[model samples]
Target: MGRTLGVIAATIAAVTFLTGSQATAQQATSSTLTMQGYGWKLTDIVGVYAISPSETYTITFETAAMKARYAPYYTEALKQIRDAGIHIEIGGVEPVDINQCGPKNHIQVTERYRPVGTPGWSKGVPCPWQPQGLGRGGLVIYNSEYWDGSWYISKANLHNTIVHEVLHAMGLNHPNVDLDGDGTVEPYECVATSYGNKPIMCSPSGGYHTSNMGKLVHFDVSGLKALLANARAQGIS
Candidate 1:
């Protein structure tokens, strides 16, 4: 299992900043900043995969059809991620059997993704409430079982989901949560005004949002930047 020390340490560090010169520095840097006050435990190494130039990372899919559907968007999203200096190593896309759709299966998948000697499925299955892992090199298993029939899994939704999960893997918690001592995190009541009217990152239904341009966008620059900054602060590659 991924270690929890990073999260604890990050929390402590954030809390420390809340009371000292660090707080002043933070305030001076960006007023819009709101520290989420959470951290991730480093369970695996962060690296880039799939795309060439050895920069962009990829999400290995379970089938060619799945890749055909999601690759384009994944490629685009990855480019944005790379531009931010984060290198994601996407394993080659492959087909995961139907048997690998449940919690236990996901655990096994996590093991495959984790480096040798690192924590793996032996850590116990992940809680259903938390689809993403608590470690640095997190694994997001996308199975048709959870999304096949759901409208939330549309092409647009897939893009958003991948981006959102990638952010989670990078150690960014939900921005909707109030971590900067604010009373509460932003809430999404509907797709219309969700994600601060940005992209699908904070969408209401955990998917895509309707855009004025009639295009489906997954994340806004600000949200992406925030996530990147948090990942950097946590020493995530």
Candidate 2:
């Protein structure tokens, strides 16, 4: 496992993505989580963060109504993570005071029904100087635009969007590989598998579509395990 991680790290660092080109890449400055190669500012190359098994991270919604509305979607997303055998209890439905939503550990999800081409259309962790590490949670602003009629996205897309953004808060970055022969990493450029095209961490636009959306592939689980293993190695458990 150590050998494999070493290879992955080296390969990721070696392949340079086109900086400031893709929408997600352009968001480098304002977001808490960096793009592609730089996993999380709080975590190391080994994928260790300040997270722990006993910690119960609360994922509150921008409004209680939104939470209730998206309840089933959230449940399915949580089930994917929990089913991976990772010890993390994640579920909550509370309307945080607009003023109180600025805390580091206060993880809230907002709704901005922006157009598809907008810069932050489906982005998360908007704050530039957000808290680092596991103990200090983050924010996720999903594009409610996707929830409207089938202009661009579907419910499955929205579900994956939730998982993707939440994972970013947990210190995951886009697995931005140069899938195409092109020298630059464009939007949705990630590893392809027999199952589908996108890894969950793929940015701006993720890989899976309606057919396989909301499913956690092996690559996704591996990312989580990488964090836990690194934490364990550091005697965090």
Candidate 3:
């Protein structure tokens, strides 16, 4: 059997931050800046998404299919996260122990490319949710039927999806909020510049979809920077 969390409550939840999607189970914070639809939100992490300043995440592909599908996006996303002072690398498969918050300091990602109506796709599983709430490593999946061209979404949406899910794996949750105070968080709820750019980490779906870049936005970078700050606080690095 895998290890147990004991008293941690294991509030392990999945996130994709548009206002109308996913979980908010044990997240410790929210976007304090409700910029009238132009703000950023944040959360406390509990996975291998962070370790210390000295260590690299070394994310890897579980299969060649997954590699072929997401290597480019991972390359784009990791560079931003890495540039922000968090160490990360696209690694080859080695001895990864992905048994529900295993302690191997590795993140393994796989794309299932399932068929339509196959429950769903695009899931991110971050590592241990400890009392300290820092990233150690975990698994990320974007097993959507869209990969096979069965589901039709724009390339921009696809790129944003990968970036969003991976951030979840890196331990960042959706920061969407009710800027309008409409009593409900809608898909368009999170931050948006005057030109309409939402955080890639926005739940449900949002990002630089106009250009099909699928890279992290400024708000997303703030979250990663927050991770580094938290890591420093906990003396991880």
Top-TM-score candidate index: 3
Q: Write the per-residue lDDT of candidate 3 for residues 46-125, one digit (tens) a residue.
A: 33323457787777876676677777877777778888898888777543333454345567776655511233346665
Model 1 weakest lDDT span, ten residues long: 42-51
Alpha-carbon local distance difference test for all models? 0.35, 0.50, 0.60
User: What would you estimate as the lDDT of candidate 1?
Assistant: 0.35
TM values, all candidates: 0.43, 0.66, 0.75
Which 10-residue window of candidate 3 scores lowest in summed lDDT? 1-10
Off by over 4 Å in 2: 1-50, 90-106, 115-120, 126-132, 148-151
Model 2's number of clashes is 1
lDDT of 3 at 146: 64
Better of 1 and 3 by lDDT: 3
Assess the local accuracy of residue 237 in candidate 1 as a C-alpha lDDT between 0 and 100.
Answer: 41
- Ranked by lDDT, top first: 3, 2, 1
CA displacement after TM-score superposition, residue 178 of candidate 2 (Å)? 1.9
